[model samples]
Target: MKAVIYGTALQWKLDLRSRALLITCYLVPLLFFALMGGIFTSVMPEMKETLIPSMTVMGVSMGAFIGMPTSLVEIYGSDIKKLYRAGGIPLGLSLFAILLSSFLHLMILSVILLVAAPVFFGASLPESLPLFFAALSIFTVVSLSLGAVLGLAARNQSRLTMVSQLFFLPSIMLSGIMFPQNLLPEPLILLGNLFPAAWGYRLMQGFGIRPLLGLGAILAIAVLACVLLWRRQAE
Candidate 1:
């Protein structure tokens, strides 16, 4: 437990220095929120009600789908895996550290969006702060779990980038963040449900049962995939 905590702390500090982590987790997300927060509020006018949650989902998705996987690839896709084994370090330590560090980073990003959205664009706050954060944490975990699978499964950075977009782009477009899910065609709505972002956005808005079930299912499947990929790498 001590080692895990120490490793996570170290990883967080190291991630702070990583250009890719800084870009994906902080820069792009904040810029998007700043730019889109204005446009959405101005164009739709009604978007103020859900602006925070929408932008938060996009930011978290980018960090998890794009940022987190890069760190994992650096470790598992290279000689670092062998180094960890030879140095008496548990292979899972790296995974745990990276995920936890990313969770913290993403939560910070969410909080920033939570604060900034209201101040900058007059976005309405969620009715319940505690419930909002609870949902955000769950969504972040599910996202990072999926990212872990990508990171562990991809053989290299190029492949990770190509595949990460498959998750990230759909998340932004179909997640009801940009627009209402009902505006989308029936097939698109169903397809959007396949991604965590849609369910997560709904969950943040205080919708019940179905979104929880959807996110829960995604989390379970993603964690299982991560386990299987880790085992494959271990072998």
Candidate 2:
């Protein structure tokens, strides 16, 4: 337990120093929130209700899918993995530490949105803050897990950036955050549903059975990520 705590603290500090992590995790997401929140609530007044939830999903998705993977790739695809072995530390613990640190970062960013939305954009709060945060946490895990899979699978930095963008763009653009999913073609809607962002947005809105589906998707992706990471470690 103490080792885990120490690892987590170290990971947090490293992330703080990482320019890419800071940009994707904090700067970009918060900028989008500040800009998009007003555009959304102004253009479609009714959108105020979903503004916080939608943007929260976007921020978390971007950070987890894009930022986290890049960092992980830098760590695992290089000499850092060797360092872990040399230090007699479990690689899995490092992954968990990264995940936990990311969760807290996303939560802090989300809370910023939760508070600022109402004040700046007249966005309404979720009916149940506890349930909303619960859903957000699950969504974060799934998104970060997907990132882990990509990081483990991609062989190099350039490829990692391209792959992460492929996942990140679709997640935000097709996830009903930017527009109505129904407005898209049926195929696109289905495609969007394949990503966790759609389910997370709905789950945040208190839609029926979405929370369960989101939870299942998150856990399934996490298991897949674990398997992939294990395989990479074995090689």
Candidate 3:
């Protein structure tokens, strides 16, 4: 298990070093947080409060569902399945890699937001260690499993990038992270509920406040994604 753990971590670091994924690990989160913070800090105060969590969801979704696959394609390209099978790398190890990468990526972005949010905009987050962690874990697991699916499904780097952006855009905008779902049309609200990020946003909103239906929703998402992933992998 430890070998699997570190092996996955090493792959994540290697992915971060990849030219294709470098910008994502280093620059994308910063730009995202900055963009949302700058645009809504004064006008949409609550939205500013939710920026960190929103950016976090974006990172996890991208890392797991799109970025991991993108990196996998770059590393393995035309022979990914054969490469892994020949080496006896377990599917669990791949999940560990995707999960660790997604979790660590969110942690780094959180730290950056903690610092930048205060200095630039005088925003301070509520403190509640357990709930914060719980919410993050929920987001990480669902997103990471989804990333594994994307890795298995995509054919190339360009397709992976496209898929990841598709994941990022809707998840970010509809999750009520940068904007509230209430402001959107009723049809959009229903669509947002279908996304794991929406549950994550609710979890973050209630982190220091009160527990709601968020955790159960996230767990359901994780299970759903994993079941579908296993079925696909078995083929």
Candidate 4:
């Protein structure tokens, strides 16, 4: 337990220093929020209600899909893995530490958006703060679990970047964050449902069993993939 905690803390510090993580997780997201928040609210007027969650989803997705996976690929795809084995560290420890560090980074981003949205854009807050944060936590975990799979599965950073977009672009385009899901075509809507971002947006708006179950299912699948990938890398 102590080792896990120490590993997570050390990883957190490393992530803070990583320019890629800082840009993907913080700079890009916040810039997008600052720019798009005004545009969305101005264009739609009604978007103020969902602005916080929508932006939060985008930020979290960027961090998990783009930022976290890069770090994972560095650790698992290179000589670092051999160092772990030589140092008598469990392989799974790296995965856990990265995931936990990412969770904290993402949650902090979420809270910043939650606080900034209303103040800047006159966005409305969720009626239930506790429920909203609960949903946020679940969404972050599910997203990071998927990131873990991508990081562990991809053999190199170049491939990871290409593959990460396969998740990130869809989440942004089809997740009803940029626009209403209902406005999209039936097939597109169905496809969007396959990603956690769609359900996460819904879950944030109003906590419901369906969104929870949807996210739960995604989380389980991602976790299973991560476990399998970790075992393969361990060999």
Candidate with best lDDT? 1
TM-score of 4: 0.98
Cα lDDT tens digits, model 4, 117-216, are: 9999999999999999999999998989888889999999999999999989998899999988999999999889888899999999999999999999
| Residue 109 in candidate 2, Cα distance off native in Å | 0.6
Q: What are the lDDT figures for the candidates, one per model?
A: 0.94, 0.85, 0.65, 0.93
Candidate 1 lDDT tens digits, 6-79: 99999999999999999999999999998888999999989999998999999999999999999999999999
What global local distance difference test value does model 3 have? 0.65
- The 10-residue segment of model 4 with minimum total lDDT is 226-235
Clashing pairs in 3: 64-147, 65-147
Candidate 4, backbone clash total: 0
The Cα RMSD of model 3 versus the native structure comes to: 3.2
Q: Which stretches in model 1 have alpha-carbon errors above 4 Å?
A: none
Candidate with the larger lDDT of 3 and 4: 4
lDDT of 3 by residue, 134-210 (tens): 77776666666556556656667788778767766787778777666899999887777666777777776565332
**Pairing residues by index, what is the TM-score of model 1?**
0.98
TM-score of each: 0.98, 0.95, 0.81, 0.98
lDDT of 1 at 185: 100
Query: Model 2, which residues run further than 4 Å from truth?
Result: none
lDDT tens readout by residue for model 2, 85-133:
8899988888788888888888888999899999999999999988898
